[model samples]
Target: MPADTPTPDEVWALLTHLVIDTRDQWKRAVTERTGLPFSRIRVLRRLRPGPKTVKELAHAAAMDAPAATVTVNHLEELGLVAREIDPANRRQKQVSITAAGRTVLNTALATPDPAPASITALSNEELRALHEILGKLQH
Candidate 1:
């Protein structure tokens, strides 16, 4: 290790800061490019995998039912998502991303991430090391 290598406590602080900063940058980029809120984008992304009920979306998105419904309402108005009554449960509503939603997500993904470009400038060896470290940390 380098003599100036960060201590574990320093590494933890840096990681926390990096996560918050990256999330803020991502939110700015998504909003600037798509004019959609981060929460709505989150819902669309979650729905991209498959149809889900409003409650499911709420739970997954860390939102309450009413908040999820509000977000869904706006997405529906934009024609980016659709809602249908669940056949299995009359009281439930299933939400699914529309073709337009996928297109929007694709466009957003294609947008330049507004985070520090320096992160992407890392050498291949550094990138590999970072990825390996993160993978191990996750478990």
Candidate 2:
């Protein structure tokens, strides 16, 4: 490879940094707009599809059982989530987001990010090509 070209490791490092920065920015924006903690937002996002048990929620949110329980308790107190005994197994609890929670999520997501308008400078063909490349990497 030419000395001027970046190595694969260098490219990966740049991509990793970009992803981390973007994610952190997004989390900050969400918190500022919604006043919800990141842990609660994480669980709320997971519950958008449907209700889930505490164990299932913990796994989805990458949290341990104890942490999930605490977060769920907080969300419950906020009226953002509700819990009920699982019909399939009375021993477990199913957690689901409330309508109020959905409203908060929608409001937070509707807030604009600080993405550069220069991204729109790319031509349609260029954007399509970039989309294809990103799609390939995603799979």
Candidate 3:
């Protein structure tokens, strides 16, 4: 380690800052490109694997039930998602991304999230080291 190695608290702050900053930039880009809120895009991505009940979606998306319902309602209006009565539990509704929703997500995927200036300024060796270190982090 370098003599100037960051303290644990400093490392924590930097990690959290990087996460918030990077996520904000990516979310902004995706929302601007797709004309959809980041939350909706997240829901659509979560549904790509398979259909899920609104409760399950809320849980997976870390949203409350009412928020999920409002989001699902908007997407349903746009025909981006389809909600149907759950055969397993008729009281619950299952939501799935429509073909149009997949197209929107694909469009969102094309949004460019350019590297931050600090990252772009790193030397090739430093970038390689960062890549390796990040890979070693838990998924």
Best by lDDT: 3
Ranking under TM-score, best-scoring first? Answer: 3, 2, 1
TM-score between candidate 2 and the true structure: 0.77
lDDT of 3 by residue, 65-127 (tens): 999999999999999999988999899889999999999988988788788888999999999
Winner by TM-score between candidate 3 and candidate 2: 3
**lDDT for residue 118 in candidate 2, whole number 0-100:** 47
Candidate 1 residue-wise lDDT at 18: 81
Per-residue CA lDDT of candidate 1, range 1-139, in tens?
A: 8989989999999989887777787778888899988888889988988989988999999999999999999999999999988899888789999999999988777877654666788899998999999999999
Backbone clashes in model 2? 0
| lDDT for residue 73 in candidate 2, whole number 0-100 | 95
Sequence-dependent TM-score of model 1: 0.76
lDDT of each: 0.88, 0.86, 0.91
TM-score of 3: 0.83
Task: List where candidate 1 sits over 4 angstroms from the true fold.
Answer: 1-16, 114-125, 135-139
| Model 1 pairs in collision | none
Candidate order by lDDT, decreasing, is 3, 1, 2
Q: How do all models score by TM-score?
A: 0.76, 0.77, 0.83
lDDT score at residue 37, model 1, on the 0-100 scale: 82
Q: Residue 113: error of model 3 in Å?
A: 0.8
